[model samples]
Target: MIETNVLTITQLEHRYGGVTVLAVPFFELARGRHALLLGPSGCGKSTLLHLLGAILTAQAGRIEIDGVDLAALAPRAADDWRGRHVGLLPQQLALVSSLCVRDNVLLPAYAAGLPADEQRAQALLAGLGLADKAHAMPHQLSGGQRQRVAIARAMYTQPRLLLADEPTANLDDRACATVVALLARQARDANASLLIASHDARLVAALPGAAVLRLPARGELPCAA
Candidate 1:
């Protein structure tokens, strides 16, 4: 039978310069579920996300996404796997300045060596209320619009897992709510599990019923809430 859980991690640990930065004994996110990774700025929230996204290989342990073991894949294979199975919304909103919003949303397709589906790109933008801005460059859009474009890009691959790092950072309360709502709606539409890593408390209320993993200050174990 196919596994219900889209993501699973066991005995996961990462280190930098001999310093243990993140460790999770076990964690799982079932398909279509949402979860929050809450912690202070330096508590390795981003490190965990990077590991899950396959941007960084773990020093030890296993990370399984959709029944595939990440540690078993080589660097090139891992990058391909991530492009297909994982969608990442980085805190930087790294939209390409030279590309139009539509093209920016298609970047993942090119990276994954998949055919560029302009229809899919336009549809995503429309869902995010950025249909009219598709032709506009990233610089021409507002901060929130840029974010929506990033979301569109991330969702273009219809990944089984969506990871957002500090999505609401630097946004005002109203903007934060809007961003969270957009993420929830988009993830739901894509039928993907959503995991957001952030220190923001507002998300707990914004995403009612989301599984929460609180990563304590460095050296403390992470716990579920």
Candidate 2:
């Protein structure tokens, strides 16, 4: 039977040198829903995001994305699957300094061995109000513009799930609100499930009604904050 959920994690655990850094008994994010993974630094929020994005394999337990088990994929197949179905917005916004905005947005398609869809890239840029900046290099854009470019890149593939890691780091209140709104709007438009990992309590209010899963610092009990 096909799975309706975009993501399902069961008994997920990751460790570094036998010290468990992240653990989740069970979690599910329904398709097209927005959820937040909230916790303090070193509480494994990033680790969880990486595991879900297939950047780091879980040391134990099961992860199913649309009913396909993550551990079942070979390395190459995992990369291709991630590129095609998972949209990642990492905190660093790792845009290629040498590539222009448009090319940067198309990078995922190239990496996935998919044809470059220039039309989709253009639409995403325009939607983010970055149409005129398409030819500009990363350095030419402001911090917020750079963030938007990263978001466009993540959304360019029209991924089934969008995962953001600390997207609001270092932003002021107004900027944070803007960024959160943009992410939500884009995710809604793309019909993709959204999962944001953050330590910011401001997000709890900014994203009212989003499912909140508060992880604990190591050795503490997990509860929603």
Candidate 3:
């Protein structure tokens, strides 16, 4: 039987300033499965992720996650939908530098209007070896540690679908492997579908089976018509 899908996109076409960046005839991710979107930089991988994560509406095509067609929902409804089911780790890691470690991890749950549970938050941070840094600011943590904190924040709310964009760019091989494994395990335990966009082949090789989405090129300054 076909697994119920967590996210799906059909004939997606998006452009920036009239320059076509991505064109996917079809893309689908089954519930609890993981996929990797790979390509050179500027190939629209990030753009595609944004669309699926509900950060941007597809300029043309259809996108559905957890049975909800994002295009049809109002902005407020879409935000609610994302908060309840989608977890995103953007390229920047996007951690608030001013917030203490624990507070940063708990922000997602707070934003979703869910009651924050201190015990659960602590467990996640500790599991990632961040227990001691619970009060540390973002600037105080090393790059690898910062990335791990980002992962914890994403999983804190136990979302049904997780989107990670260039999550391991700053780490060394060992650190990269550790982070990848942690993410896969977390997604599996939460029964969440994970879609990661990265240029790292090592990461993709480690994932058992991950679909890849390649992007179009950035040609002559004006690009071909």
Clash statistics: count for each candidate: 0, 0, 0
Q: Which regions of candidate 2 deviate over 4 angstroms? A: 1-3, 221-225
Candidate 2, residue 200: how far the Cα is off, in Å: 0.4
What does the lDDT come to for candidate 2?
0.89
- Weakest ten-residue segment in model 2 by summed lDDT: 216-225
lDDT of each residue in 1-225, candidate 2, tens digit only: 654787888998888777788889989877657899999999999888888888889988999998889988888888888888899999899999999999999999888778999988998999999999999999999999999999999999888888999999998999888899989998899888888999999999888778888888886833322
**Candidate structures ordered by lDDT, highest first:** 2, 1, 3
Instruction: Please state the error at residue 208 of candidate 1 in Å.
Output: 1.2
Model 3 off-target regions past 4 Å? 218-225
Q: What is candidate 3's lDDT per residue for 1-225, written digit by digit as tens?
A: 867877788987777878767777787877767898887788778888888878888878898888888889889988887887778888888899999889889988788788887788899999889999999999999987888888889888788888999887867888778777888888888888788888887876667776666555545223333
CA lDDT, every model vs. true structure: 0.89, 0.89, 0.82
- Residue 81 alpha-carbon offset, candidate 2, angstroms: 1.0
RMSD of each: 3.0, 3.0, 2.4
